[model samples]
Target chain A: MTARFAVGDRVRVDDRTPPGHIRTPWYIRGKSGVVADMVGAFADPEDSARGGDGLPERPLYRVRFRQTVAWPDYAGDGRDTVDIEIFEHWLEPESG
Target chain B: MSTNVDDHDHDHARTFVPDEEDSLGQYAIVEMAVRELLIEKGVFSADEFRQGLEVFDKAGPHLGARAVARAWTDPAYKESLLSDGSAAVKEFGVDMNLTELYVVENTPRVHNVIVCTLCSCYPKPLLGAPPDWYKSRNYRSRMVREPRAVLAEFGTTLPDGVEVRVHDSTATMRYMVLPMRPEGTADLTREQLEALVNRDAMIGVTVVPAP
Candidate 1:
């Protein structure tokens, strides 16, 4: 699937409770952020159950998140930010 | 943080068994069985298996440090480093077919952190097999949730305004953080810089120069 976000575009990591054979990091689940970069697409490693020698390819995006936005009352300075590159399935358009 | 594994082990004495299970016992039971089965099936020779272990035992992080030092010394080479890591590493002569390298950078506003949610995906060709703590589930689970706490445990607390970027190395690409240089090391050579570069700096736990 094509990447739905672009550099500097705001997005949020969707908080989906997946079951069995999961890889999206727990800390990042439900965290909101902006797309900082678009790393090249690669074959989806999670869709191994499709029963094919090769899996469908999907794009991954590097999202930048401000720590203050993620963990409220985070005592450190608000300028602290984190950038994590996540696969397309983990992200979605921000609602508010 | 204290490298003393004992400091954190309050209840470890209750579970300690020094002579209980030797590596030979575990290897003899499980690894030997697997080796025997593979040999019986003619999958690989015993000699080949032993040779593989020999090669693995010889690998470590110094090679990666050499590459880092070389990059620091050469400007054009550092450019190559920022662009393509594996090719730049090749100039130092570290190569691997199965593993690809991604060099992450640390900035005043943005820090690069790394984790292996699946298994420890380390730069073995340079950094060697990941350390025992790195392979633990505690580090994998806690690092993302409380990076600052963990970094503090490693004796590295970021400045008030510095950003913290955590890179999870779970997929095809393995990552190593290229930490920013420290002050007071003005006339130091690349070798000196490499010495200042610790494994924790590469992991984003501690910065260079023992800070």
Candidate 2:
């Protein structure tokens, strides 16, 4: 599947709290970050976690979020960042 | 009282060996049951499962150390490792088991650390099993929240100017830190350099000490 986001694209993680197996970390939920890299396509992990064949792969990206943005009281250099792996479906394009 | 083996009574429980299955808890029993069901169903042979276990047992952190040492010595190879870590490790015959690898480099400007906040998803093939501390809920939760403080607890005090980048392994990607080569290691061979690297350094908790 084609990746909806590209490197440097600002995207916000979908802030849904659906019940069941989820890979996205809670601290990262509802946060916005820039796509760092497209780490190839892979089967949807939520599908695989439930014993179903994770076919129709989805694109995954490495997203970079500034620590200051993620945490209000972040106690590190302004340049500090957190990189997380997020699936295409968990992300939405951020508009200025 | 100093007891001697020669004068000891030979009254030990000989036939009361503890069976592995009997000692297992509910989860282990379920795992054994599932394995037996799969084997009974001819999904895979017992020998295949045994061989897979043997292969996993042989994996160790030395594999990752060697890879890091190679990267320290060879710039071109280091570039490949930083770009496509899974493929680069494959060149040295390390199997990633279909998981993608991200090799983050530690430089003067940046210090990198890895954690699986969701669960303990580590690079077992390259760096052996996850250490107990890495699997702790405290480390998983705190590392992302206050990385610099957690790092200081490990005796790693990064300068204020150096940015601390934390890589949360929340998805399929596995992370390994490529520690900066120590100042005095220029003359050391790759094999010698490998000796300086340990599991903690690769996890980004510490730096490779100058030898």
- lDDT against the true structure, each candidate: 0.73, 0.89
- The TM-score of the first chain in every model comes to 0.81, 0.95
Model 1 achieves a DockQ score of 0.32
TM-score of each: 0.78, 0.90
Best by DockQ: 2
- For A1-96, candidate 1 gives per-residue lDDT tens digits of 566788888788878887654556666689889887676676665675355433556677767787777667665556666666678877788884
Per-residue lDDT tens digits for candidate 1, residues B73-178, read 7778778876777777776666754556778877777677788866677887767788898889999876755788888898887777777777777555667888
- Runs in model 1 deviating more than 4 A are A1-4, A49-54, B1-28, B39-51, B96-99, B117-119
Give lDDT tens digits, candidate 2, residues A1-96. 678988999999999998878888888899999999899888888898889787889899999999988897997788989999999999999874
In Å, candidate 1's interface RMSD is 2.6
lDDT of 2 by residue, B1-211 (tens): 2255454342243235454544768898899899999999999999999988987887788989988999988999899999999989887677888787789999999999999988898988888899999999999999998998899999999876898999999777899999999997888999999999999999999988888
**C-alpha lDDT (0 to 100) for residue B166 of candidate 1:** 71
Clash pairs (backbone) in predicted model 2: none
Native contacts retained by candidate 2? 0.89
